[model samples]
Target: MTADQSVTEPVAATGAATMVDVAIVGGGLAGSLAAAVLARAGHRVTLIDKRAVYPDEFRVEKIGGPQLEMFRKLGFIRGLESVACPYDRVLNIREGKLVDVSVGQAYGLPYADLVAMARGQIPDASSLIVDEVTAISCSDDVQQLELASGRRLKARLVVLATGMAGALGYKLGIKRRVLAAGHSVSFGFTIARRDGAPFDFNALTCYGERTADGVDYLSLFPVQAGMRANLFMFRDPADPVMRDLRRDTEATLLRLLPGLRPYLGDFHVTDRVQNWVMDLSVVEGHLQDGVVLIGDAFQTNCPAAGTGVARLLVDVERLCTEYAPRWLMTEGMGKAKISEFYSDRDKIAADQQSLKMAHFRQALTSRNDIGWDVRRRLHFLRRSLTHRVDQMRPGWLAQVRSALRA
Candidate 1:
């Protein structure tokens, strides 16, 4: 466990109500990380969740880029390194030809492990309670919660990180306005060669050949089990091809992307097929008294765009480190104070960028107009050309670009 330095002393919810400075109502990534951050800062924090441990969910299994930087800043990079499978290179291809190569640090692990890692960082493990928050009564000064186990909790403020489970938020007049329902479909499972040898590439990404297929891309990366694959598509959930992909994964994948056959080299799925139909949504009327929302609880992201972690990190950083602490110093937790987080420049930018990337990926994969066709070609061509130039010049181009910016 990455959080071995921290203790795991469970806080039992007893007969009477417990009081804390802050109470977070979700034990997932955002809530857990917030609890750890606040508790480490010597705040009286309580984190409540229905499940004691996060299940092996097929969601956001990889973390990299600015997400890694945020984890480092929040003091979770060591823990992440302890549990994640690290890889630094990804070979990008299209139509069986090389497009480019991406070089950066990334980690692959199950979503459950990531949550556990974050939860373990709480300085006082007893601050975490395993229970469901049935109802909440919010005010400017104090927030009260009713638990399913018949216990109560009172706090100065509340953090709603319940994710796509919006029933609790709905009760508080917080509603999710769906931007796109069934926006995309994603499949996750492990794969290994039939002969049991390792794959040649460290990581690989294969883009769709034609727009009609609605196949965005197939990403193969390393995980603890083996090579993990995440296939993203913009097709309808009820499409028969979805069944084919689930039942005859390898064959159907080859049929849709014949170019992938040579790279795969007689591979077979090593685990049960897990998939999700994503919806692009944002919570409206969330700026309420005594509470604020973060992560998927605020807005959901397109898995194909790979912006979920980035947005959530911005939320956690702004809320826990900046807004929450500052607000706690003052008197009340009214909508006037909570609205600052929603209007933060960085948080708003991240949210908008996630939506923009969602549309861009969908159009890049499925748009059949002449403009997009030309764009798709130019996109791959530009990347390929840049990769070639970088391969020849090594760090020279980067240095020149940096100097130019200066």
Candidate 2:
């Protein structure tokens, strides 16, 4: 689940009720962090998640750049350090030729550490409820929930951090559209000798049309020689590329990197793979009169940036600071203010994602075709020409152009 896209289905009547300051739905990175932030502010928080613990092994292996800054500010730096794969380079490869490296300052850390750090920033784990929310209702002063066991919680405010498919967003009657841009995929993981993998510790690799059949993709974060680094590559189930990943991931990888095939020193799979649907669209507005959507609820960026956790924490950082605990408890910021904040943050994220995707789309659509054709060599040259994107790069304007086209 990338955002608070889940909803509580309407349930049978129940009478029990408990009061809380904030009700947090979903237990993923965003929901958990929101629980911590609000708890630190002294708000009584009741978190309801379907699961009792974090998924033991995750496919999202690293966090870098602005997200690292957000982690440090939120006090997750040590947690991130404990399980991190530090990397500074991000390599871009089209067909077999090198294209460009996205030059950005900042380091990458492990996903588990970032999640733990954010969760640790809050008061305690005992406060949250590890159960399902069957129904929810909101009004001027109170927001309510009904547990599957018939218990109810009424809070002063409800924060929806459920990722895509979480119940509350659907209940809120927010506008939503199913995204078709990317397919669901899993990352294969294992550690290699420092010399075994020749990847730069600071760089991530980007492949234009990662599959000869056509699929947009990027590989990120290289851990130290002894530590585990993730390999994220997948084909849309509906696309022709699915036959390769589902049947033979290893064989597919070998085909992709012929030079690195001999370097697999005792490499083997260790855990069940983790995967999720990738939605590359934004929900129009994330605020309604009685509820406010945060993180993936508003918009989900492409995995190419690999900044899902960073973007979620960015939401927490802004909301916890701007609204202030004292203000939310009193008169409430109302629907208008909440919607404005969601829109502002959504624009920043969407604009950044828009820029990266534009370059990615062009690179993906033609890299392989042109790489094989010397006469039609325009595709490979086009990618190399516009290699990086940042506030300093001219590509920012290119992004603006694409958004208008969209």
Candidate 3:
């Protein structure tokens, strides 16, 4: 199959139409990965997106822990390594003192590069269509998509991976119910030392000092550009400090996190300051016929909790690798089939965990109640003590703990 170079008028009166086993509406990480997995499984898949190339967007910039395992299981780990900067250690600090160290292999890259890497996994380049899905009509047997270019796509199933683009889903009567509007704010920017010297730490995480500040933590990790910083906050979006952070990032960051000053050593932002005010939401009225919603189309995550990628990975894995193939083998794409994916044990766990973590992070960061205040201090103390013990015994304590678990 050859790629469609451009979106043109329909080849036939009903507008040029192509048939596929699955039609994916968005080409973000989830959509692209699903397309790659299904296509590799020998399914005729069509991936459509508004942009030919994903733009530099302030979204999930790193994939680690279980997310890495999922990527490897899906056969995209090599593709990830090719485009991302890998780091295995993160120095975690609080109030200018070491709290703990996270030791794990992780990859940092622009979100667009990650999406491109997933798309590249598809052997047939022509399987991806660069066009806009203006509308969709889904039924139990066949699903149809109308493109802005008058091209039409028909498939047995439709996967809506249109991350946070509620417009398309709204047209289908799917509505996003806001769980928490403006749940958190996230800032993404690159940083470099003033003297152009390398930093001592491969990756660093600096937690906020005070609950009043509404700051969660500042995560500095390596990317292709340089040291990339992601500042997650529970503060109001209209706060004057937000503007200051965008205009005078280096200085404002120091002011918010004074302990960060000595570690950064006269650094400045190297690129455009990108920030997002995320709303925790889930789509309602979506458990319908012939269609499945994944990723942000199903629900949005709190950046502070760092669960977005994990949730979406579960969506793609459970839907594409398991439910989707089984559904395809059956007669129709009915609500009963769609509900199984929605109610899948792993998918539900991931989504619920995301919401639970979101609330936990917010409470830990800004809640001033007596119980939370005590919990906050104990949290850091426990981490610090664990780190100290680990430094003394190396892997001995971990091995002992693992043995105890067994």
Whole-model Cα lDDT of every candidate shown, in order: 0.91, 0.59, 0.92
Model 2 C-alpha lDDT per residue in residues 1-406, reported as the tens digit of each score? 2212243343345555778777888767787777887787777887777665565545356666677787778666766676665555565665555676666644444454545556666687776676677677867667778776556788777777776754557666666665546633445444344345543335546353444444444364455424353444444546544455445655665565543333343344333434444656556545555566677776665554465665677777776656536447567546755665565665477446654664455345334555544523565576576554443586785688799999
Q: Indicate which candidate wins on TM-score.
A: 3
Estimate candidate 3's RMSD in Å: 2.5
Q: Against the hidden true structure, what lDDT does model 1 obtain?
A: 0.91
RMSD of each: 3.7, 7.3, 2.5
Off by over 4 Å in 1: 1-15
Q: Which has the better lDDT: candidate 2, or candidate 3?
A: 3
TM-score between model 2 and native: 0.73
Off by over 4 Å in 2: 1-16, 57-59, 88-113, 179-186, 191-235, 262-267, 284-286, 324-326, 345-406
Please give the distance, in angstroms, between residue 75's alpha carbon in candidate 3 and its true position after superposition. Answer: 0.6
- Per-residue C-alpha lDDT of model 1 across residues 267-386, encoded as one tens digit per residue: 999999999999999999998999999999999999999999999899999998999989999898898999999999999999999999999999999999999999998988999998
Q: Count the backbone clashes (under 3 Å) in each candidate.
A: 0, 26, 3
Tens digits of per-residue lDDT for model 3 on 69-181?
99999899999999999999999998888899999999999999999999999989988788778888989999988886677889999999998988889998999999999
